[model samples]
Target: MTRHTVNASILLTDRPLLERPAAARAAGFDAVEFWWPWPQTATPSADQVDAFVAAIEDAGVQLTGLNFFAGDMPAGERGIVNNPARQDEFRANVDLVVEIGERLGCKHFNALYGLHADGIDEEAEAEAARANLSYAAKAVDAIGGTVLLEPVSGAEAYPLKKAADALAVIDSVGAGNIRLLADFYHLAVNGDDVAAVIAEHAQDFGHIQIADAPGRGAPGTGDLPLDTWIKAAQDGGYDGPIGLEYIAGEGDPFAWVQA
Candidate 1:
């Protein structure tokens, strides 16, 4: 049977941030993942981290994946890894992310590459990203974790919109722990042939997130063949949990999964 992990950040928005893990458990999922919870500051207070840890522990859910601190996601910032000014800020969060992972036994972390910033040359941005990714890789290595690079859609200025695009950066990083995050919704939104991508690069993926295309809703809400695509990923050797990162809208978000 296929295992699923809820994206607590997006899925259980009706509840408090610390309460989402329990909500996911109540929805019948045993595992969960999240984007950086503290969007405004990379370094959240010790009490804040403790509460997050307690939430997951109290919920009895496994934290399957996490994103390192990206900038204010609500404000449209994708990440800080590639920004020259925020390089230090990105670096500062690496250890904290790793510390959380160590406490939670979570091994997968996503690192979002920011859009091209003004006044910074392309070379400088690329260099900073590579250096930071390498640093994150090294830190996570201590905990035997993997750093994930995902291709996003809807943000035209945000680079790495394809599997190959992220793979090239992984190559440059040259860390075995660095791998691709195959978010099917984003890939399909960006006009990628999802089936072909699954067939050709399933082995390259470290994690998989899903939502239907066009609507970014539950699997049945759109035209994408999510079942077939998931089967393809499985056939191609993807053994990880599937992340439910969709917009639930009004009705039951997990109704499809239950059915």
Candidate 2:
């Protein structure tokens, strides 16, 4: 049988990170992922990190992945993968996240490419992303964890809109510890064929997340052919958890899946 996990960011909507594990368990999620859990304004403090770890143990919910720092959250930066000025900070953040993952018994973390800079040479940007990813991959390997590089749609930090592009970056990094994170919503928005891409990137994909495209809501709430996509992933030999990373609509987000 296929297994699934919920992104705590979706279920715990307004709750603090420390409280999300229990909430996820109450909501019947066996495993959980989160956006980021660093020293940002939105994250819990050091003490809260300890408490969060305890909560996960008590709730018996596995911490599947934690997004690396989203880069100065108060300023609305998404991440640090492509930032030249913050390369060191980005590396440090990855180290910290790996530590957190180790402490929490998680093995995966997200590496979101930050916003693209206008007028920057495309080749230069790719090189920068590759270098940073290499560093992150080494760190992940050192800590016995894996990192997934997720591509965003709107801005072009790393234009990995297509599976080929994502795979190419992974190849450039040349590290087994770094892989692609296939998000159906982003793939659809970027006009990539989700199922075909999943099949093509089978060996290179580290994790999967899903949401309805138009509204970014629960799987069945929008036009995404989730069942077909899920089947394709299964056929592709993907046995990892498919994270429900979407927003809630009117009622219980899991209602449709439950039925």
Candidate 3:
């Protein structure tokens, strides 16, 4: 009875970005989520955004979550909205991200707190992140949407490596719409107590995403108790769709969902 959402950015890697919506539908997913589709932090043109939106609509799938501009994801760029120098890029993309959400009825927006640039100390970058995140919260709130903060694992430079870390930032943002994104894969990869965190913070969780630990592969492919923790979240009151954000390693991504 659990509902699942596929992350098009991670699933269907063989297809073009926009085309992944149909691929998700073919895989039996009715809702999908994605990171920023642009390869760089630069703002994508309106035409490109439109095409992406149209692709989702034509595929008849719902967009459940989206990330603000994260630079070069494959090359290890996290998110740039926290960088003072990159504020313009983040601000520009906010409108675009929100606009697409408006069209698709998507309410979740993720803000990646990018690592610091050379000579930019941690304290300074954290300040910039706080300011930019507040700005983003207000912008998304205008359209009746919620802003999500996630903790990414294996990327030491990214800073938000634990649920507590992300929750701290959410507190600083101080907006009613701001909430934590509890991504189980990242939490386990970083060695956090997954069930304990979910049990404690389920109500504050605006979104949930999962993949197995140690390999970032499918559920049965790793050692984590994906089901136990998922049930824990639901029992604790997290009714949001759990996104299947994992690497497809030679198997159908929907197999776990079907089971």
Candidate 4:
């Protein structure tokens, strides 16, 4: 059977992360992903982590990936890449992600490209993103995992929004372990041809996240061509989990996209 996973971030906001395994399983998801696991907000403590791991195992649910290191604390606007001042913080974040992956046996990690500073040269930003990706790739490589560099929408300062721009940064990084993570809502937000773009970057795509275009809700809740894009993804040789990273609509988001 083909496997598709939903992120716990979408379905279990009312409960803590440690309690998400049961929720995901109850929702008929065989595997799940999450945004971040740090500082004990959404993440569990060490003992809780162990318990959560056991719960998932007992429930027969897998963790597909983790979106790591969203932004600098407090402000939470800018990303680790393209911000020279946050390189150390970025490295530390990468370490934490790797450690979590090791404990959880996850194979994929996603990095959010935060906003850039004003007056920053585009080329310089690309170079900085490439360098940061390279560092993350190495860290992921050491753990036998791959890193997906995601270009988010709704952020004007993000250097990479278009598929071509993200591909360029991935090429510059030149790390075999680093790949592109395409988010459907973000692609639509940035006005990219979603199906065509995914087809074009098929080989470089490591994972996919999906939601409705306008409100980032469940598939079919908005105007994104989810069926078309999903077909295109299959044609492009993407065999990993299709992540449901959207806001829950009136009911189960998975119901809208069931094949």
Candidate 5:
């Protein structure tokens, strides 16, 4: 009896942003998650925020997770955490994301570690990331929320490419509220043993997102043993909703998981 959440940003792209929540609900999902809805603007207008909130509420879906304003995701920028020039923007986004999460009762926020900035040294970038992550962790602590650090693939510039990579950052930050977002598809693409990761680090997971390797498609569309991996995660104590953060094939995306 595991629950599932839709990554509306990727799953329901055929519809308008505000409409995706209802579309997901219509598709039989009770919960949804998103990369920041406004990609270009870190802090959007109040009206924009209200509208986003209303969409989820009107659709009667719980917002299970959200990513803190990662810069221009479509343009190859992973995040701004490691950028000194954009620190203010990242901090602004943190407050806004937390506010939205509090209104919707969402508890998980993914903070994508940005690509290395040209002028900054590796140690400098790492220090900046630690500071920003600590700030995000503290902001969410008041709401009993968790900050997530995920390992991503497909973007070579994105430094974190394995479970251990993200976990190391979590350890350095030393924040109890910060944890790992073990995205199985990304891990598999990066060549990590998904089964071993599940068995070894499920307890450190704050949330889990999934897609299939070779192609970020629906579970059955590729070769990853998602079902087996998920069961191992469950056995190791990860009881949160499984995030279907995949690209749909020709037909319904949820068809593979439907009862």
Candidate 6:
């Protein structure tokens, strides 16, 4: 069976933010991931960062993947790495994110390139994104970390609508530690051949996150050919933990199958 890292941001919504790590451990997850836990601010207070790290440590589950602060998540902010106006905010959060990584022993970082509001020059934003990604790469290199690029589906007209699209951005940055984050749910939603994608780029991926399509629900509750894709990923040389970034609804989400 393939072991999975639970995405605490989505799976443990029932509990308070600080308690979700323990909740995930109780749910039988030995590893977990998270979006930027702070939604309101790109740069959180030192106390906030320390408490978050403490919670994860207390829970005893390894943090496998974490997102860099983009903007207000619930309010539809995807990422600000490409936004020139928010470049300072992104910069301020970069080292803080790396600091947290040092504390957690986690080396996988997800960087979302949110859509800059309309009328902005696409070229400028893309350039800003390239520069920012490179900047992040330099900081994380201290810890031998990899920065991730994820393409969300129909998310606010975001430019990275596909895995290949994100790969292009990663390449443009020319950072050795940058890699693609193959999210099955987003790929499936956008009509990408999930298996073929895995077959072709599995080796280039630093992380894999999944959920069922149609509703972003737990696996087996939707029509995604998860087994085939997982097998393809394995056959294609991806030996990393696939993260479960789905909604559990009202039951034990980890009950999908034993890892």
- Tens digits of per-residue lDDT, candidate 2, 1-259, equal 6677888866666777667778778877789888875536334467866776787788888999888876765566767677676777777777767777888788888888777677877677777778888887787777688889887675554456666677777787788888789988988988887878877776567898888979888876779998888778877777788998888877676786778
Full-model lDDT for every candidate = 0.93, 0.77, 0.86, 0.76, 0.92, 0.89
Residue 161: error of model 3 in Å?
0.8
Please give, for residues 1-259, the per-residue lDDT of candidate 5 as tens digits: 8899999999888889999999999988899999999999999999999999999999999999999999998988999898877888999999999999999999999999999776679888898999999999999998999999999998888889999999999999999999999999999999998888888899999999999877899987888898999889999999999998988888777888863
What is the alpha-carbon RMSD of candidate 3 to the true structure? 1.2
**Pick by lDDT: 4 or 6, better one:** 6
lDDT of 3 at 141: 86
User: Residue by residue across 1-259, what tens digits does model 3's lDDT show?
Assistant: 8888889988898888888999988888798998888867457888888898999999999999999988787888888866878778788888888888888898999888886577887787888888878888888887799999989887777789999999998887688898999999999889888888987999989998988877999888889999999898999998989998999887666686566
TM-score result, candidate 4: 0.87
Using lDDT as the measure, name the better of candidate 1 and candidate 2: 1
* TM-scores for all predictions: 0.98, 0.90, 0.96, 0.87, 0.98, 0.97
RMSD, candidate 4, Å = 2.9
Number of the predicted model whose lDDT against the real structure is largest: 1
Off by over 4 Å in 5: none
Off by over 4 Å in 4: 39-59, 72-78, 119-125, 257-259
lDDT of 6 by residue, 165-201 (tens): 9999998999999999999999899888777788789
> Residue-pair clashes per candidate, as listed?
0, 0, 0, 1, 0, 1
Choose 3 or 5, whichever is better by TM-score. 5
User: Which 10 successive residues of model 1 have the least lDDT summed?
Assistant: 83-92
> Which parts of model 6 are misplaced by more than 4 Å?
none
Question: Which regions of candidate 2 fall more than 4 Å away from where they truly are?
Answer: 38-45, 72-76, 119-122, 156-158
- Candidate 6 whole-model C-alpha lDDT, 0 to 1: 0.89
Clashing pairs in 3: none
Clashes of 5: 0
